[model samples]
Target: MTGYGLHTPIEYLKGVGPQKADVLKKELHIFTFNDLVTHYPFRYIDRTRYYKINQLQADLPAVQVLGRLISLGQIGQKRSKRLVAQFVDDTGIMELVWFQGIRWMEKSLKVGSVYLIFGKPTLYNGQFSMTHPEMELYNPAKKNIGNLSLQPVYSSTEKLKQFFLDTKGIQRLQETLIPWIAKEIEETLPTYILKSQHLIPKGLAILHIHFPSNMAELQAAERRLKFEELFFIQLKLLKNKLLQTNKFKGHLFDQVGTTFNTFYTKHLPFPLTQAQKRVLKEIRQDTHTGAQMNRLLQGDVGSGKTVVALMTMLLAIDNGCQACMMAPTEILAQQHYHSLLHLIGDLPVSIKLLSGSTPKKERKELHEALMNGSLDILVGTHALIEDTVQFLNLGLVVIDEQHRFGVEQRAKLWRKNSIPPHMLVMTATPIPRTLAMTLYGDLDISVIDELPAGRKPIKTLHLFESSRLRMFGFMREEIAKGRQVYVVYPLIKESEKLDLMHLEAGIENLTREFPLPQYRISIVHGKMAAKDKEFEMQRFVKGETQIMVATTVIEVGVNVPNATVMIIENAERFGLSQLHQLRGRVGRGGEQSYCILMSSHKLSNDGKLRLQTMVKTNDGFEIAETDLQLRGPGDIAGTQQSGILDLKLADLSTDQLLLQEARNLVLGIFKDDSTLDQPKNELLRKHLSRQNTGISWDKIS
Candidate 1:
């Protein structure tokens, strides 16, 4: 087969038949011969060096040597029988034991035979021993028998291994493919680029990856493969972005800053922060351009993004265009409606709300008013995308909390109008700058770095579970002072299936400790009905409940300013960003707020770092940076749902410099030859095509 072509079926390959091939396909996802060849080992066992029995430590994993086996014996009867062999090598003597598989080793081992054994060595009662060490027959003709070298450990199922297709079997397949790859595959990269990058050839990389002679060769092969994977994935995303930019034309609302300036001059609640003004200016530039403005507006909580979005919406309305804002939930949509109604009260524009639960009569009226240009601003959840809803002239579509919406859902909103509406995606979760560049590369980004006035910094504290009584006393004092409290647990009820039953038990204990008569408490959780959840939320919002005990459902947009004390049980269970969002809920009011993170006495390294970051800074951006460092790009910003690029090998956190270099090189190549038809560019294209089969470069061109 050629380099870019598929390999023959595994059934046709040596040793493998239809039944064995079926097992390999089901267990390892390996269907073809090429799939079996390319299923790389997760880890390599280095056997190049061996340690004497005396040097073995009980805690650390080490490989030790044993001398010739003087005698081999079996202990116990039939089912419970175990084989024991004693030997000595260099420094000391040790015993090698194997259970239930003594027959195989008995045939391989001979009395007074010296064999090389490798396994985790353990010391028990001043005696060293290894359980089931991988053994081989002693060979006197082999040179430098002590130099064992590294062994590639490929993952395999017991059923497949029973058929002799284990790691060693896979290694044999790899050995067969190496020569074919070298002879049939052509070098797609130019010599200059390959030499400049210090990259190994494809054939050499494949061989070294499977069976490296040294550590340096293994590292080089890994680097080359990882970089190639990242480069092709990025190339595909960039190509899609280019196609969108060239094809999609925006409405391009004419700039009429008169209305915007009037609101700022006369009716503005407070002076706009410099950060807000800067982001607004950036949005204005994008809106006035003819190209569809796909921009990401990112800011920390309380960064005045709502005000900026309101101003941008007004700009569209001033130009005789309609605007809509889509929020992730109904509560957030209602909150936006209330805030905008208050902000634009004196203006002539009409603002309306349409949620999933909106009355049929009200929804019909909203649909009619929107189509007749009676509605200037419409705010809702996914309900706004229904077929009956139509806009007079939808110009701008603002999506609040961009991570919550799926790609197809957003696309449905874009199709609500003839020309795709200019998109302004807003996210309250601040992302690290390096990650933002890679994830949101297709969209221009504007960050609001400043918080609005009267926003007090929240006081954060970390406490162990042993301090629960003292924490409860402090919570009671705060409640006595007329401040509300929120107690959040990770789980709603005790599950027989889950390991963490403490959260559910804690909730029940809290109910008993602070009974409803003493403290008006309301509970909300994920499993509750929507109406029940809304009722509980309303009770808390109306001050009928002084304390709210809930799960992470309140993590998104449940705004209650009266709540001053926030307590998270088992804070170690949450991610850094999630902890930050839960903390954001309490500090919204004028009163002083405190966030107390309660964790167990024992914490993992990452958990300790997460809690420490929370205690050290109230700045969401700083917390986000720490999260990016601790969790890496894939988890910090969920690539699958965030519309971010899902990279196979490139780690956005550690490989920022390499990512920039790759981006620059790809951009430079495309700038000179858009179709990548030049001799050098053609090689780069072929290289990418071989690496990423899912990306259709021909369609892109």
Candidate 2:
């Protein structure tokens, strides 16, 4: 069908009136004929094979049988009422039962009718029976099952079933629509691509996806559709990348002058790792090219990302342009400000902190200094993105924990100057290759995949609740060694009231065990005021407290070198990526650090796998890959509502090869035709124009 025909209202389709259309709209979001056509089935059943009643087994999977409804009757009273039909084939007899829809089934079913029933078989009292089996009238003389090979099973909800829009009802709609759609639908991909990829026609793929002739056809249809979905995504990303590099002219920072060299040689605390050096070189090249620099820096926690960021900012300063770094939280912003302040000891550069908690008079002076070109580097939270917080010749922008900030928020920072700044978005979360390709394909990517020298991998240990005393003893031992500890909880309050151990109760328990004068503990969580959280964090940082009991609020920002033991309460409740981040809070210093995962005995399979992954390896990328597999991309990236991840058919976990191939294909196409204006690529251009408007944040990052 043409685009106009595909966009036709679902209410106008055959056998669908306004009420049924509204039900489909509300329940499944199927508004247009295209939506209905693209609602692919999750699985399929083989209708070519039928089992006789005598061959039925309770443990067998769903089976199909041809039989006659010899008798029908109602059994049991009121709520327990059920409609039962005695079905018999040439070999033997079996019972078909319906409980909840008894009245409807009783009114519709006819006795002595030949029916094709499909359902899972169960044995009750030595008799074979099927519950809520799918039934249809059989006519062998007319060859009713002539083309029935693989029967597609669609997903439907209870609400949809009430409106007669069950799986079978949807299948009937497809049966009525696919023949016309297959004949009228236009091809979306270019002829060259279709030929090179050996892909079936778009319309044929659509038909086969919903109603396939065989297993091979279904697989081919899936492959084609997956490729198309991933192809368009990569095309948009790479195109945006091309547009940014070609269109936005960024500030030129081609000098390695006083600030960067003086800090690198004079007051540098340690040598930069090769990975860090490599990333800086990449950024260095990007800034020198004069194209707007939008690079994503990925590294594990404690991998010297801040140092790289500072050096990049120094490069900007050396080029006579100001730089700024934005963090997601006040604690992180403060940490960066202090860490930078300490690192650039007696250096000539002027750095300041800006956040919501900054006093009015201080904010006024900071703003003045910022606009007068006196402030070389400004680190702050979301406060830096406000309209009043403008910068003088802002040339470089570094965002920490980039995913926590929305794209629009980052875009606001991008608009700080007339010409967009060199954007360096830093994330400690290691992204899987597939996810990074799909979610961040538009941005240039650089990964610092190694840790700095003298850093030892944190040893991970899993413990059950029964080992509480031993864990407490170990904590005391660590505390006695003059090394601090951290106890993290998933919840702050007792509101959960379930098996989870919240922070408040944990505090009471800790106080009882460690007793005041000898052991001081600080408590923090998301609900605390900014100042209060900062005070508690400082206590931990200054080693005034032996243990800090907090929630995941400390996951990203708090850095303490003296703290060596991290006890995560109810660690099973955390995702793998989160657990890794929490584990990263310790082990910052040279001494060997340990991460103890304390959980109840009721860990689920996923929870167990997460713990096992933590214990097995300290590689953030590996944990991220496992996290993607366990939680899927939306949960890991928290971009489900961004419209960037609104994929229908492609699975990021399993389709990595296809995604890479699609990206490579796009790169190849761009080499030949940067813009799809050539006559041979006309189909691709048209299809892209018809796609949903590109993501607004693509150009900025």
Candidate 3:
């Protein structure tokens, strides 16, 4: 065997010099042979079929043609110069054009020589022509040109092309690199798994992934590789969970005291939904297990997650311990404080709001209460993690909209007590189960899928700019019925490039239409000061304002049960998740609520699909799944910085079944051998150790 292996630097490869390797490293992050081998093609082109010149159609994908170059010349001035060639097949003639490589094409072409041309055909005026067609001299002796195998198309950049490294160039490098390491590659999975899953060997899968001989072989290669990728990730997450349960000790809350029973029996405002009851039971089971609870609470906007959280905190207080809830924004913190306060209803549990806007004197008193175990529950923004805000026996932490905070910030909250507190992070934005399994795989998840009783799903409608007057009339009608309305614009201020309506112009238009004394409108946005924004939100909440004009700043944490109308201006600029969240702002009250999505006539296909999806269903999970398909997992709520999303092949959108299978297989393996110390599990143990270099955040939730 040769000395070089997968670890060899890419520059030492046969066809790659230092300069070309540097470009590859910067453009495609290919620093080693393994990096290049694993940089699989996004797609492949069929090269076995050759289209006749006359059979070519307009706007068709790239096609291959065999023809003879009969004439070639340059036209136009230097700036507009283009090399044009007339190539004739047995049936007809077509023009091959190139605008960039004029001199090179002029020097390379020979008249009356048969050549192969491949490119997309475009119709200009009345004639079909190909621009920058790939040209090669036809040779009947070699079978490589028209082989049955598919041609790989690797992703490339203009900078890489400057060094003669485009898609075709990268394919050539793979051809040389794959064979060199194929023999040296080692199997990562055990023999039993490979046999049970009907997977090919690792070496053979890598070979076929780069250059498959047939469609079936390519699919098999993809299946094997995707399973491997997802399997290792599941193993890591499951192992983290196992280690957390075994290594970390948590403060046990083994009793339900007067506070929890009092609120449930008398002060509870409404009956709890079955889904909420199930989630509370899950939390209750975790808190008393003597293991630190790292749980994710997911529910739709009006699903009463806050009530479940309040009850969980009461359990902590009943055990002679303190509980704290942290929100990403000050507005959300205050909302939680008021919600909990109203729910407590003289239950003798102390709850206070501490945020950046809190006065110094109030913070001092709140700190004292917390240190002396007097503050039963504290709700605040990131301020709760401050050094001075210490709890006497911090037992539980509830983070609302947890994705908005960074990892280190969440870690700070976990480090508040000598023993890590029970963590129950909540999100109103629904996450698909596949995504939840991958992103929060380490955390135990409990979803409150059902909305509260007596709540109606928001009636969603899509409207163009022409329907503005009618929408205004409808808004006035709702306001006349003693219901508040919300007009959410995508832009807070006028933008030069965007022609959408801004909040300032929208407020002006509303004032002109509704007039002064009859309609009281409040304006709020991210740019407004904390107190001012809170005052405007409070006005809308209290029915003092008939209409509230704002940006997406009100998308979360602003709960106005009386606001029955939500009109989102330029709704096409927002994504499906954002649109769903904005729609959730309404539908909190018993009366039938409406969410009107207003946009210009000009809309992309994606924009249309998003609006249509919102109008079709109120199921946030379905909407979230569609959103995951429309926009991949990266742009979702919390998966952006999740290093696990750097998946090379496994698509979280389409690979749901595969992900589940992998997860189940990992579970089976762990059930048999938790430590992976058995002889049959040594491969997995070695692979996991090799990948365990990053800092473990399992204990911090």
Candidate 4:
């Protein structure tokens, strides 16, 4: 079938009736024939062979077999009948049991019959057994050897499984669709391109992916499919970026160095780090170009990305354009406002803060000032994006923690001006270079690789919960030296039903151990009102509270220079990135800071690795890389809610080489045929259109 003509709705497919098709549409989001074709398997299970029952071991996910049924019986009452059967092969004797369907098993089993049973083996009552094993009765007349082949396990809903539409049912559909696909779909790419790139034909790839005969065939099929997915995605994004650069003209801000130099020499309090200087230069170069700037600034906890952002904002002001900085939360917005106020205090620029908490009258006044170009810089949360708030001549929009905002919200910031504003995004989470290129290929990237002078490295250590007394002693010493401490717990409320420790109970215990008369302790959690939480955070920031007991809500944008000690309880429960963020809450001051990770004795290998990685390195990029390795790509970049692109086959951690190859291929192809309409590239266009439909293609034509 031609790509455009193969537009059959999924309900019309063979074996997928209306009812089952509805389930596929609702659960797997498969609504069309193409969607069903592209619904790839997450992982393939090799079921080509089985192990003898005697070779089974505990705590292993292995398939094993039993010999023949010697005796079969049903036990228990009518409502709770259990089927018990015994099997004795030449190697060993074992039992087979089923709890849900006793009558069905009695009808299927025969005392002297031999069968091949496949399942996870286990030890029950000091004897080997399998519960609810998949069974196939031996039939010499049919000469069937019980499907010792690789199986495709498609994701299905329980409702579909109840209707006998399980993995095997999906395999039947695949088998029926194979001949149609082979006859209808032609090989799109040239044979030379396929042979040189080591890619299989589209028809062969689809068939082998569902039912491959060997490992080599499966690997080749997977490579071709993964490459196609990533290649089209990169091509579409790069093409969009190229079009934007060529068509849109930007207001060049070339006087950035003059303003920055004047501020550094006369009004600046401290010098910039080498890494910061390099990133600032990159941003300046991007701004001076006729093309609009799209850049991402990544740095570690105290690598000084905010200073770079402030300097870039100054460039906008120097060019007679207004700038705005948007943060994710009210507390973070206020924090940025205070920091910028301190840095540009002596300059002639006017900085203002706006948030949902701002009074009605004050908000109106701020809006008026913003529209009149009186406020040189405005710092706020999503409140800045309200329709009532307008910019006089907005040129630069700086988004801190860019992952927190969605694409639509980020685009809305550009609509405030006639010309789209140049965007500079900042994030403290250091992304791996390959992932940055794939996800942010449209944007130039800069990494602040060093910290400022006088900033001390955080001392990290791991301890068991039994070392609480010693840790408290260390905290007392730090407090005695006029430094503060932060004691963080995992949960907010103490539920009597749960056995885990909570922040409220920990706070109570701390208050009893080190009474409030000796030291002031404040508490914060997600459940508290925003105003109360802000007030408590302010106390800690001002050193009015010596120690703050809180949950993970303070993991980001809470800077306390005097707070030199951080103690995280039950650290094993948190991911590595979260632990790193918590550690970042401290170590902002000139004084030496320490991060104490305390976990229970029972720790998994991943938990141990996370804690050990914390103790081994202070670099956020190293921590991010280790986190990706340990936890995969899901939690590191968050899920789709964080504006993270969810690639189907390419793993951002292990597929770096594949990503680079695909990126280079895209650049080469586009450089040759900008529109991809050359006769040699027509197949590529059809493949892209058939496979990826979400990417906008209007500009390409």
Candidate 5:
């Protein structure tokens, strides 16, 4: 216990002194004993299974074989040099090779000794080979429990290997430390929890997780550790939610006054879909709960989320409280401003716009109007968060494309009001339900699942770049019908590294194909000046341009009802979510919209999956789920920075059952004991207080 506990420095462990300790800290972040114990293997191997040389297959994951080394020699020149050896068993012979650590391995190889080797097998030139295999002397007396147990394989870097701290080296240190770690560690879960969940004790789980004697033991170890890790996360999120709901008093907008009802009855352009009405009902309920509301709204592109946000804002206005909607980009903010203005025609609501490009005098007038409580609804980007832009009675805040903003920026919005205005965060990028539950676990989620009634399902097609002329013909036909077209390139300039279509090349190609008098073209990109970009986007939106050549700048909010064709150049470079959002740019009008995904023939498997997903279905949730499985939660747009998805073991995409179980258990516990102050829940509080596995999402959300 003195040498090994949660806080024991990793440097004190055997075989880990100053040099190796520094590498461990820098490379793997193993600063303490708990860090080492919890550095669970991404995978493990069963050492007991041994195959003959003849049994080796190219597709084999990792196979173990016993043979006697017949020869050892070096091959190739300086940089390409490798240590090559051959081993022969009673059945056959196979080659073993090592490109790294060649000098050390060449000296260590014994010519005639029986050796046990394990590695992934590859077949080349009709011969079997194993590169960089783990080898050891095979002796019955020395190969006892260690040989029978599942061996851990840790991830290592070239730098770590240079310091003699590769997977095998780290495993040796673990072998030295595991005995004491098993004895000194204390259970993190309570006795009641362990009993109810049928979990093994903490110390034993740690031991078995690194070196399990059998498959059942390994499974049990994984189950216990995953439960503990996921449990703490769920508890932390629930606690944040509870604190927000309990500690902060909400601005009660109980009145369903004129602005809300009058607009719903008359000025509404179309009857609200059942999903929209349902979301509005939920938001309406949250505003009057006497507790600050933190809600997340998720819907596909053109799913009428903005309409719901507009109605909710009117609720705040009806109660004599002002509301503001913040977007990630100025272009998006302006789009919202125009959309809301059109929706609220003749309604007498004084809606104002603010962004980075706002005129000085106009900005001053907006500030005055907002301070005087005369602005009913304000729409803008981060410019709205300026300290000088004070709100008179900001009661509700609607943030569009919520993922584009960081957690701190959102928290800054929270600080804008004394009691923290009711928040409605929205994203058109559909997140999987399981992910939404974890990533936005603290916020109540309202999903508008169905699209509007008049809208038709978009027709999607995958095309090779060789078919560009055919696509051009289709675009010409669409333009002939007075419909605009969008030709989106994945890049703004011709990047030498990536041979994809850029905006400049695309504009030239389109001009040559469409000719001067036949089509007017507008180009926009991120590198363009804000004013110029906005001008080009507005020209395209107003149908002054027959074709718009742009980057993903149109991915967020550039609504053109007359645009009937969306041709994405190098579509394979775009992710599933981005492709879906870009496809959303079209299909806004009723004239049979089409989204043509144009990419080169050389698409990787992942790129093929993305393109196939776009062509297969328009279901955003389904596309989001496939994207999660393909790109993982870390690479997804929002979850990368949000530490909520920084899970070590439990995968939000696949481990839904475990997440649900943990969430349900926390719900039950909080129902009876909100603070976890009950006598039986003391262990939970202690565990949560010391939770430092990764970044804490409590303060972020």
Candidate 6:
């Protein structure tokens, strides 16, 4: 009953009891004795030098020897069983094997005594084995008084190693619960953040992070537990973004009437890029700050994010408030309701389209013109979060590819109206700036990053497979200059573990290279039938298919401006932000488009750094920081079901300078205690009120 604030009952500690404390509360969620002393260990082995079977090799790293079973036996039988043994040490002999338990390791071998085994050693057949090593016995004055100098490991489960809880039985229950609570672990940071981040006190950083007596106190106990787990997850996402911008209260939109200057001066189909007038002047200064604009934007794939989400839905229809946009498919809400009815042509602004295939009398007259504010902008999919979709004064929503929708489907579009609207979101993938500083650190981001002035930079290249007949003669010279062609692939069949290019055998090898009444193709993928992938993506968006043959489900809903060559094939099975979104579906046409990539002359150094960063330079934040340093932030936190960087010792891709020094010491402790009601920050406010995670995986889902 000391400072781990003892909630005791881990079936009364000492090697656990009530059935290994119900298998340590069903496989390692370890209930109490403060979850078995904060079940830490995920690495640490040094066992202070031992290696000697002639210092084994095969890329030797994990070692420790002083061996000797020198006997045991029994091998290959039922399910090819094994046992082996041999061991030896003072400079030679090896073997050890097990193939699991081997009759409880032949009734716990003791033949010729001397032990301390540990692991890692391979070299098979020309001899030297090891298999599942870690043993014990040998003593040497209790291993020089620091018990085998550093050990820890813990992360177990094959049903808690069939209840012996392996990781050396959870390091023999943390070597009996760390000398009974490592002298009562207490300090939860704040002795001026332990002498201004020099750290190391919570009881010697939990007894040198479980048994460290050396390697510089295990790198100062892994920098004081990865700066107390990224300083309480950036002080719980900056105190739920400062208590949600001080409890809501937003809807401001000071009118920019005449439906946003009559569509930015006569239906603006081009010319907004000064990074779209600096992200429409940061969404018109966050809808003239009354707060609720949860921003984000990002931009990249044909950056003109649906023309800055239709000029911020014509600034919520010039303030009489009503706007929406949802996406995440209905063929990207009928490709954004036919690109905002072809960019507000004839704009007396009334906009519609809701989906799940509308029509029941056009979704009952588009839900009585979106609940009577006579609909000013709707565009849909996730069927506009139907609670029978009501919004009359929706006041700007826009989500589109917002990590393909989640946090309870964008909190049912923030429970529509009665305040809480102004959102924005958008994505076109390009996230990495340390995963938008730990998952869109409470929004407000904006990016656009320039692309519109006379658009041409595409030109990529990289071919191979002997440039398939010079990429079918540069796709029949860009389909005789009427320009189109996509080709894509990375399997849609023929996958005996990928040697890709399949989309039905690349459209039966491009219908024998430009066949069918002089080349016609189309295809599309995610296994069609969304009205047959919107009729083969509107016959390659009305250029009547010069060639589409897809899969990467036209990565981010097709928007074809008379296509203009993409190609891809196995291009080293993609990912550099999916070959920069399949090279932004071919520079959304203004001519000179090309992407190419082909592959198969065996690429792999991350497929030649994603075809030399797609022939060097299109940028999407430098290919999302080289796809977050080649495939990491767990594939961009796999659609961020926000586990706030489910970090174990911080690493939002190599700790951005310890995540900006744990977000600048939680912004200088909320700038000298903004409600952490100072008492020298009462143990950082009772360890953030006992690790309080009351929902806010950056606002839930």
Model 6 residue 324 lDDT score: 87
Cα lDDT, model 5, residue 357: 78
Model 3 poorest 10 in a row by lDDT: 692-701
**Model 2 bad stretches (over 4 Å):** 1-4, 48-61, 76-81, 89-92, 100-114, 139-147, 691-695
Poorest 10 consecutive residues of model 6 by lDDT? 692-701
Stretches > 4 Å off in candidate 5: 57-62, 70-86, 95-111, 120-132, 141-145, 691-701
Candidate 5 residues 141-169, lDDT tens each? Answer: 87543565578889889989998888888
Pairs that collide, model 6: none
What's every prediction's RMSD, in angstroms?
Answer: 3.8, 2.3, 1.9, 3.6, 2.7, 19.0
Give lDDT: candidate 2, residue 643: 61
* Residue pairs of candidate 2 with colliding backbone atoms: 1-184, 1-185
Writing each residue's lDDT as its tens digit, candidate 2 over 1-701 gives 34447778999888999999999999899998888999989888898899998898888999999989999999999888888999999999888999877878888889989899989999999999999998878866554322467988888999999887898899888887777777767888898999998999999999889878889999999999999999998888888888788888999998999889999999778999999999999999999999989999999999999999999999999999999999988888988999999999999999999988899999999999999999899999999999999888999999988888887898899989998899998999999999989888888899998888999999999999999999999999999999999999988878745768999899999999999799999999899888898889888898999999999999988889889999999999998988999999999999999999999999899999999999999999999999989888898765664567777889999999999989999999989998898998998888777774364574465
Tens digit per residue, CA lDDT, model 6, 236-303:
77776776666777789887888789888988987787887988898898888787778888888887
Question: TM-score rank, highest first?
Answer: 3, 2, 5, 4, 1, 6
Native RMSD of candidate 2 (Å)? 2.3
Candidate 4 overall Cα lDDT vs. reference? 0.79
The positional error of residue 542 in candidate 2, measured at the CA in angstroms, is 1.1
Q: Determine the backbone clash count of candidate 2.
A: 2
TM-score of each: 0.89, 0.95, 0.96, 0.90, 0.94, 0.40
What's the residue-level lDDT of 393 in candidate 4?
Answer: 91
Per-residue accuracy of model 3 over 389-463 as CA lDDT, tens digit each: 899999999999887888778888888999889999999889988888888888899999998899988899999
**Which candidate do you rate higher for TM-score, 2 or 3?**
3
Better of 4 and 6 by TM-score: 4
